[model samples]
Target: MSMFEKPSQAEQELKWAKIWFKQFSHFHKRGGKANWDFSPDDVILFLRSKRDQRMPAWKRMKILKGLLVYRRFEQELPIDPFSFIVEKMKEIVANERAKQDGYDTIEDVVGVIDPTEPDAIQQFRRALRKDGMRLQTERSYVGKVKAFMADRGLRCLADFASVRASDVEAHLTDLAVDGNVAASTQNTAFHGLLKFFTLVLKRDMGPIEAIRASKGKQVPTVMSTREVASVFEGLEGVHLTIAQLLYGCGMRISEAIRLRVKDIDFDNHLIEIHGAKGGKSRLVPLPDELVEPLQRFVESRRALHEHDIANGTASVWLPYALHRKYPSAHREFRWQYLFASHRLSRDPRTGERHRHHIHYETFPRHLKVAVDSAGIDKHVTSHTFRHCFATHLLWSGTDIRTVQELLGHSDVKTTMIYTHVMNRPGVRIVSPLDRLSEATGRQPAGKSYQEGRIAYAAG
Candidate 1:
């Protein structure tokens, strides 16, 4: 409103300033001491908006920390008024610093700690995404990092460098000591942090060489052949098909559920698994037995799709918009799932309720029941089938490479773990004492057992 101020500049800045003020006012219309506070840099942006100007990209980012500082510390001015005097907003920061320093007790001091410092959680997420981390990995990183920050009172990304490895060591030790986390479990968590520091934070954590974890004493849980059969037979309907796929295709539950109708190539006898783990896709030979069950499922699937379309419920997946591209693709055979969800599911990426495939969680509930009914006499789960699949394949003289490919393992070393279960291929030697005859120079009752069964089976 100054007379000497450039009319165009003054008009542009003040006009948008008022507009932004109204937005905040509207946001806090039902408010007490409306918490929306803006700092000097925020005011600069409001003025910049008026002149139809944007701050230089680098300078633009710097303003967020200032705004965060304003929101967290200064309660005197609304964001709009602060935006005008953003450059002169240093006093509020100093006051916060003074208050932070004023606390005598550790608990009070911790309370005074600024949570919005540099907002590292947000920054770390962006960094991980840019680094092409998987959605699951990104989620894990967020959970682990958020917990770590909350526990240790981290305010900014820069504070990570100050987070001593010893502190992390103590935490890992505590987890192992209190939670009884095995060495491997502890390593996974510690390595997650190591990845965050070395990869995301770009910190020179020096290979985490000294990070030693307590080793875990664990045993592999393998479902017996009889148990596997029992669980396999006890399953029914889609649940049966699901378990069949688990054993038949040697697939994890996650991989089985992600299957689409298009993934199976009946003519080529190939089943394509896309980016199953570690973002790598591979094709495995389709089990011949699965073809029949899959065909039966498809018959029902086609009907379901038709019914859904007729009832305005089918055709859920919509072939990823292929319905629009090809127009007739919705009714096509390739577009139908071999094992389809009766109803459509929403597209997580698009937020559109279009069916993708059978959900991963559905079959497992029924699988546990089948496990109990089969009378396998062991605590087993769906993953037990996958474990048995690899072991059985190895027992049937399947090559390690073939089994590895079928199991979708990136390394042969992972497949080699199953080798321990199959045992070495060698001749069994009987003790000389077993050759002894009884009474009439013939084998006695107990001694004749192996020969009788061997000869009987031979007959």
Candidate 2:
């Protein structure tokens, strides 16, 4: 085509497709197959590769659309399989364009917290967000700080500025003595107040000499193997899979639900847990029995992702401003949550509609029902499974350091708690009463006087 002449529609589409295919070929070399010998998965991989390179969303979409046009008109290949990609890319392009036009993007929206919230609380929240605190942590901190302000009649920023260390100390003491809050609760409140004064108010808080809440050394609740099996019998489908992950992989409920499709490696028999407690990542061994079930689960998740794509809502929330970095990754299959919620929900932070993982609370509710059905008397929560995981591993002779790493504990001291609860077969200690009975070749007497006399006479 001459410089002044306009290219035909067919020529333009072919050019677009060729440009995309060229880039795709660089990533995936065509040895003996034709240039067009690629599947939807290949197309997805190519798009993801572009995303990783931080390519502009519009450019990526243009190339992909060109490929579709060329394949349909020139190659006469079926375009049905690529429909999901087309729809998802169109949505991405529209969002990018909207952002370019100075429209309010998802990032511009405020969180679900009330707009009429106190200015001090809002400032505290902003500081927490700037520090990359988790949403739950932010809420807790804000609540505690707000309570402190309310209790002290500090209605505004100026009031917060006047807060002294003694005031904080007295308030915490009151929480322990008057409110009767638990040790952890008081400590959480203390930390929240400390952060608010130090970070938000920019004031130095002197040493806190408040009367501390009494803390007790409480062991975690762990289910026996039989009770675990009984609970499993009550749970089915996604809940069962999640419970298994909690116990089998030593994963916290938050870690299990937040899992992405790419995190699971079936061939390696490993699961990658990212952004776990303390913002750490670790690999856990995938149970042999879970391999097939997880495969089937992922396949179903893919189908659900396709449906979301067709509906123009195929996107997930990426942490740490990753969406800004990899614009197309949010819509990729690998980023879709492993255990996605059935319905689309509005993001609290961005106010955008996206499919999040199943709510963390849902598992515990199911677990409570399962525990009750299993006739378990222990107070069982979703976290009990994690405790069971650590204790059972120790019981089965797994090294403590290995268990610590799998549980993602930074210090071995945390993992040592399980050793107290774990039962050792070889080191098992017989009760004194049982030992006495064994030595004398007779059963121990009952506690009642009449039963004790009869048992003594019989012996």
Candidate 3:
């Protein structure tokens, strides 16, 4: 490309913008729209509004250079202002990350008080809190109820009275059809709506005659013993120990991450899972293999706790009114998370900065890396270890009832799925073909009944 040859308008614009941004752009600190509105004149107005802000001459000149390109592309301004100011984008990205890092409480992230949410939706959320639902449960139920209310345009408590069974049915149908939501998701949404109508609106959610989403029982993926060993071989340190607990106790990822210092009882070789699924408490055996490693891990956690205490940032989240009842419980070691995060985070509710648990995502991310390095191709995740725990126990001839108790399952039927997933070929009726091979005889295609009697009987 010679200098005489004209470059495309888009290429020319990108080239000019790149030079300006790298040369200049982060000279002043300011906020921009979380998502740009993308109207050219509106963008220009936004830029003009920044003129009154005190910034250096270089920063002003850079803005002028960007403005020329934006005006050239004014008929079709880019949705992202950062694309034209790449160097200026790092500070904005950093600010977003800082916000997330500082956010420690679930109530801040999931329990947002949306001003636009309807009165009935607000009441439903309050009802959920009063009933003492888990933070994750409350978030799910509130979001579903909000979607239902918005679908029916129910703004006030009075508007809820006007809602009918058909409206609810239509919403569920759309969830299955338009949203293509799974059977479990659709069922969860139905339950949330049912609670809202029954408890908050004081009305029965009459029969929903709509076509329901297919609720087929899905067989959970289980790791073979060899696969499980390979996964563990690829992991070490805290991650390895966490994976062991997941497989050893048949604990869910959330249950493991939420473990507090007092949950593990090394003396009795027991682990108490509090507020498990359905708000039930249960005790599971702490594996003899993990006891020593776990004790070491807990000692390390104690060191971290002491460090935080000296820095005056050792508070942990206390459920319900325990903080009110105990007052000092938040600062107690017993309430501190066993798998506490390395970074300190600010609790939006109390403004008390503290260390939360290792982020839930970190385990799966590192687990994936380990799995790849080990060259195991099957789709495995942190939860796969839990599945392996239950399935392996069943294969080892452990009583179904005992496995159910250890897994904190409410029904033996829920625990029964592991039986179906276990590698139990001999338990199943042997096929005649296999029996024929074992009997030192082959199936003769033209043989009469008498000729195959021995093979048939053996089978």
Candidate of highest lDDT: 2
Rank list by lDDT: 2, 3, 1
TM-scores, all candidates, are 0.58, 0.72, 0.66
Question: Candidate 1 or 3, higher lDDT?
Answer: 3
RMSD, every candidate, angstroms: 19.1, 19.9, 23.9
Tens-digit per-residue lDDT, 1-459, candidate 3: 221124675677667764443333332222322222334344344444554674443454456556446444543444344444433332333333334334333233234445576777767775664444566777798889878878877668887767888898899889888888888788888889888875587665787865566767778888778888888898998899899999999998888988999999999999989877787889999999999998897899999899988988778887654665678888999899999998988764345676888988989998999999889888888878888898998888899999999998888998988887633635666667768866977654556566688788988
- Summarize candidate 2's per-residue lDDT along 1-459 as a digit string, tens digits: 221124575577687777666666667877423335578998898888888989888888887887676677657888889878876885676566546544456333224555688888877876665445789998898889888888999887877666788898899999999999998899899889878876577655777878878888888988888889999999999999999999899999999999999999998999999999999999999999899889999999999999988999899988766676688989999999999999989876667788999997888888889989999999998888999999988998899999999999999999999988635655777788888888998855654667878889999
Q: Candidate 1 on 1-459: residue-level lDDT in tens?
A: 322124586445445444445544444452423455534544454545533563342333334334434344344444444432433333333333334444333222121223453567665655554344555776676676676676688867777878876667666666667767666666666666766775456553442223344664444467767767778788888888788888877887877876777888889999898757776788888889889888787677677776767766444445223444466665555666666665667643235555567766778778878877876666677777788788888877889999988887888988887866644335344545655553348666775798889999999
1 or 2, which is superior by TM-score? 2
lDDT of each: 0.62, 0.82, 0.73
lDDT computed for candidate 2? 0.82
